[model samples]
Target: MAHRLLLRRFVSVTLRGSSGPVRSRSSALFPSRSSLSWHGTGPPLHHQAVPATARGFCVSHASRVTFNVQNQADFAERVINSKKPVLVDFHAEWCAPCRILGPRLEKMVAKQQGKVIMAKVDIDEHTDLAIEYKVSVVPTVIAVKAGEVVAKFVGVKTEDDLEVFIKKLTCT
Candidate 1:
């Protein structure tokens, strides 16, 4: 019980500063106020929820299927030249929409299994890729296949809309 309380405090502290996933054993024992659920040993905590009033608290989640684009060469090798279609999310750490959309996009992409791969690129960290891709805005999603960009969009989108976009790209 003491450990659970301590874990809860840790989660609270971690989330108080930034909006991201909180992994706590207590989260499984004691459900959070938000929509987080425990599904096995290590599922991405995308569903982890913190209080809305919590300052700097944002929910972030990533799946094992997702990859973070580290640099220009990595992008070229993993996304542009990959066998599967890659959904590239160009975003920034300070972007609120990116925080909201990040986990949601990961969830949606995970449902596709291996049919698609999601790549996250921080605009600040990978400015070159963002500029080359013409990502003037944060939360820009680009679909790349066979070394070419097939479709791209800006801003947040509903899960359904994103699925439709992926379907359109994969169907071709």
Candidate 2:
């Protein structure tokens, strides 16, 4: 009906200057239509890489704020040697407090964008890491900068407290 016509017009306007017969309203929106290859069925397939400018807008920071430590080597490489300050969260799946703190800490860290990153380490899976860090508690958060421990805390903290802790770490 009327909605379908409006959608068709919108598509034509947005896809102007494409390799296909359809003409778009603005060629600047998509500079390289050659990257896209049309097949007989379904949507067009992308055969080549698209330049960043042609890809439209994108976020500069890393989208993921939290990651799990696979092993000792992973912790050494990702957390110990990270350029930005890292908040190492040593936790256990069975611990209720650990479960609560993990998500809150991730939310706070994500708010900081890429200023700080979070490393999740399961105490049960990686006992060696917990022993090395002298973490007897189930939920422990240690802030490391330049391969050194800057600050640490144990037990679950309030959301406001977690935000303050993250802010302090990012500030330094």
Tens-digit lDDT string for candidate 2 (123-146):
899999999999998799999999
RMSD of candidate 2 to the truth, in angstroms, is 11.4
Runs with alpha carbons beyond 4 Å of true place in candidate 1 = 1-62
Task: Write candidate 1's Cα lDDT for 51-133 as tens digits.
Answer: 52323433343455698998888888899889999999999999999998888889888888778899999999988888899
Off by over 4 Å in 2: 1-63
What is candidate 2's TM-score against the reference?
0.64
Per-residue lDDT for 84 in model 1? 92
Best by lDDT: 1
Model-by-model lDDT, in order? 0.79, 0.78
Pairs in steric clash, model 2: 16-23, 16-24, 17-24
For candidate 1, what is the total of clashing residue pairs? 4
